[model samples]
Target: MKVAIVHDELVRRGGAEQVVLDMHKAYPEADIFTLCYNKDKTYEEFKKARIFTSWFQYLGKSEKLIKILYFPFAILAMRMFNLKGYDVVLISTTHCGKFVRVDKNASVITYCHTPFRLAWRPFSYAIVNSSNMIIRNIFLFASRVLRVFDSMAAKASDFYLTNSKEVKARIEDSYHPEQPVSIINPAAKLDNFYISNEVKDYHLVVSRLEDYKMVDLVVKAFNQTPEKKLVIVGTGSMEAELKALAGDNITFLKAQSAAQLAKLYANCKALIFPQHEDYGITPLEAAASGRPVIAFGKGGVTETMVPYNGDSARCTSVFFEEQTVESLSAAIEKAEMLQFSPGFIRNHANLFSASNFIAKLKTFVSRIYNLKTDTDFYMSLTEKVVYARKEVA
Candidate 1:
């Protein structure tokens, strides 16, 4: 079957882009489409795929500019592309994933990370830190318009998929309550685990230094620890701020190769995920390296992090509630108290392996599409109910 995967911008690889990559692996024959494709700086692995781009790709050189330019480009490109030829239209979205207008006969399924924060989380750090006032204001003023378009896009879909149960609830509460929504948490490519042969003394944190990412909180929490050192990976605008705030213990790293990161993850005493993530791929990496994750108790962590119950179900990680120095300090202290068997971490991490995600996705697709089955009657009934041919394509 010919499938088409769409996203807003393919500038830098983060969690959202990984979803596209996995979708590509799932549907090798599918065409990968996006408003902008920053090919020159794209991850080497995606170089071979049939990446189709819109005119805005020329503006993809700078991600700061690309984020501002992608909205209209993505929305306008719906009129520019003929998506009717594809059998499955899977939209891996965070922002403009639901912007496209599909043919009435095409089956569109959107895996929404969340609605654009400008609409849902206007006060969140990710939205308030916009570079341009004009564009941000224009987007804010036209938020209703954007919401209508997003809703229409969702309404036009045959089904909806969410990365977490939290996200699923939000979709039901905010948009597409009538649509069939399913939960498919994002999977991790566990092979990328960076387990240094020789252990490092410092703790490691790999995240964009955004206010929402709460690297500031991590810094504050670690500042009080005094004993453990910190090595922060990834750079952002707040680098200078974080650097100045750091004491003798915290170290800032611009970036590192996958192998280097894996080594760091393996060697660190534990990975500190201060921020509440949507569906964190980093914690999985740390656990894959036989390390524990100390994170804030919010967002998707509740679903993924298994708290220690007993010998049979030991937690891969622990969570802290108050995003303050004291709370994280307590969690870190608790991490020291527990003994994590390397085998237990690897076993839990296996559940979210990329290969497992592919198998599960294929099964879901078969089940949703009502592909030939032994229970012909039930299959026929769902085929009629799910394939809203006249409603969405």
Candidate 2:
């Protein structure tokens, strides 16, 4: 069957982009469709695919400018896509990519990372950090209009999939999806990561330095504790501002390749995740390296990390109750005190392998399209579910 993949944009790399890459791997022949495509800014692997871009790609040369123009142009640009002949259109989006018009015969399978945050939550970081009152007002007005467009787009999909139950619940409450949302947590590249016997004193934070991510709070937490070291691996608009806020002990590295990141993950004392994400892939990567996490105790991180609940041996993470510097610092201190089993943590991570994710995704597509199943893969998954239930009983 002919397949096409649609994504919001390809301006920068993130968990959403990784999902698109994974989908491309599953459907190697699938052509990619998007609002914008930046060959320099995104993954190099995308160069292998036949990428179709909307007019938004010509709007700007800089990623910053592209992002600024995105919201206004996204819906219209996605609607302009001519995805007529494909048998399956797999939409991977947080925003307007779902607005793409497809043939009635084709099945639209949407993997919603999250509903558009700005559209649903107007007083969010985007509005507050706009700086210009006129721009903020324009954005606020646009959000109200986009919310309606977003809902209409949601209705176009034949099936829904998401990264976490957190996002699954959000999709149901926000879009009121016709079909039940399937949770397929994004996987870690287990082949690239491994545990190290010699761990260093430093902690790690691997995220885009965005306002909503709360990286500044982490910098503050580490600033107060000069004895602790932090290695931040990412670049964004806030890079300069975050560097100014960070102390001498904090080391900032531009985003590394997966192999380099594996080394960082294995050697770090723990990974610090401050954002309330849909489902964080970094924490899982850290777990794959057998390192524990120090995280804000909310959002999807809670679902992934095995938090300390009187048993240090069983936990793979330490959660801070609040987003404050004091709370996060305390969690960091608590994490240092805890003794966790590296082998056990790696075992937990093995359940969310890339192969497993692809298996589930293939099964979903097969079932949806009424195609023949891979009997061995299907039976293995069924047996595991049944065994899990038996364990609970």
Candidate 3:
């Protein structure tokens, strides 16, 4: 099949990129496409894959801002792109991926991470911590425009898929009530984290320091636990302010390589996921390396993490009730008692192997490719207008 996979950007290797990578593996012959061809520092380190970029980059930040300001520009751009002769179009999206304006006959399935919170979430929240009113209002107005485009994109897609059930619920409520949606979780490679004999006595939080992510909450909880050490391994707007609050035991580092991060996940006492994430891949990465995750009891973690109960101890990670320092402190203390076996943790991670994800993904794509567009497809297309017209006549 001549598959065309759409993505938001090519920069910053994260969970979403891993999903795209898996699609690349499943459809090796597929021509990858995206809005921007981000100059990744480690693109060559990955296996060979054929990828393409839109000429939208030529418009520079002005077009980017326009696209961001008026989401229809993005939708129109997707419509304008000549995707003729492609059998399948898989949109691996966080924000902009759903805008694949192609022929209705083409099978398109979107793997939505979430509705863009900047667009969907309230504007009052955006202005909560911002100082400049003018910039914030501009952002707020743009976000409304973004919402309209997002809705249009969702309606345009053939089928909907979310990375988590949490997101699936959001899509139904926000985008379309009648849309068919499924949950196919994005996971990490357990084998990537090796069984290291050396133990490093520190807690790890490997995430961008975003406001919703609440990396600062982890810092606060760790500060309360002076005996425990924290090694934060990603950077964002909160970097300078967060670094200023770091104690002697907290080490703040920017983004690191896969090898370096795997080492950290393997050695840490536990991975602290203080935020309510959409679908946390880092927790699995840490568990795959024989470490338990300590997180707030909500979001995707609820789906993946079972309790470490009785003899089935290794099958789970620990959770806290609230996103407060007190709740996190108590969870940390409780986690100290839980049994963490490298073998058990590794076994738990096996359920989320890359092979399983790829297998299911291939099956889903095969169905779309084999679907009969002539008889059933034409009949359905006519049902929307032609059949109604005949009935009216």
lDDT of each: 0.74, 0.84, 0.74
* lDDT for each residue of candidate 1 in 1-393, tens digit (9 for 90 to 100): 667888766778788888788888888888888877776556667787888877666555557786565556656764365676776788887676565555554556778887665556665644545648876676566666666656655555566787888788778876744546788877877888844456667778999987778899889877877788999998887899999998889988877888888888888988888887778888888888878788887888777777655542377887888888888889888877788776677778888888887776777766655543445754443354344433433
Sorted on lDDT, best first, the list reads 2, 1, 3
TM values, all candidates: 0.88, 0.89, 0.88
Instruction: Check candidate 2 and list the clashing pairs.
Output: none
In Å, residue 212's CA in model 1 sits off its true spot by 0.8
Which consecutive 10 residues in model 1 have the weakest lDDT in total? Answer: 384-393
Residue pairs in clash, model 1: 106-393, 107-393, 194-262, 194-263, 195-262, 196-263
Indicate which candidate wins on lDDT.
2
Residue-level lDDT tens digits of model 2 in 1-393:
899999988877677888888899889999999888888878888999999998877786455675676666666777788788988889999887888887665667899998988778777666557569988888788788879777777777777999888888988999876567899888777878999999998999998888888999999999998988999999888999999989999999997887899999999999999988778888889999999998887888877889989998888899988899888988988888889899988988898888888888988887866531454643443343334223322
2 against 3, candidate with superior lDDT:
2
Q: By how many angstroms RMSD does model 2 differ from the true structure? A: 7.8
lDDT of candidate 3 over 118-139, digit per residue (tens): 6787553646347487877777
Off by over 4 Å in 2: 129-137, 371-393
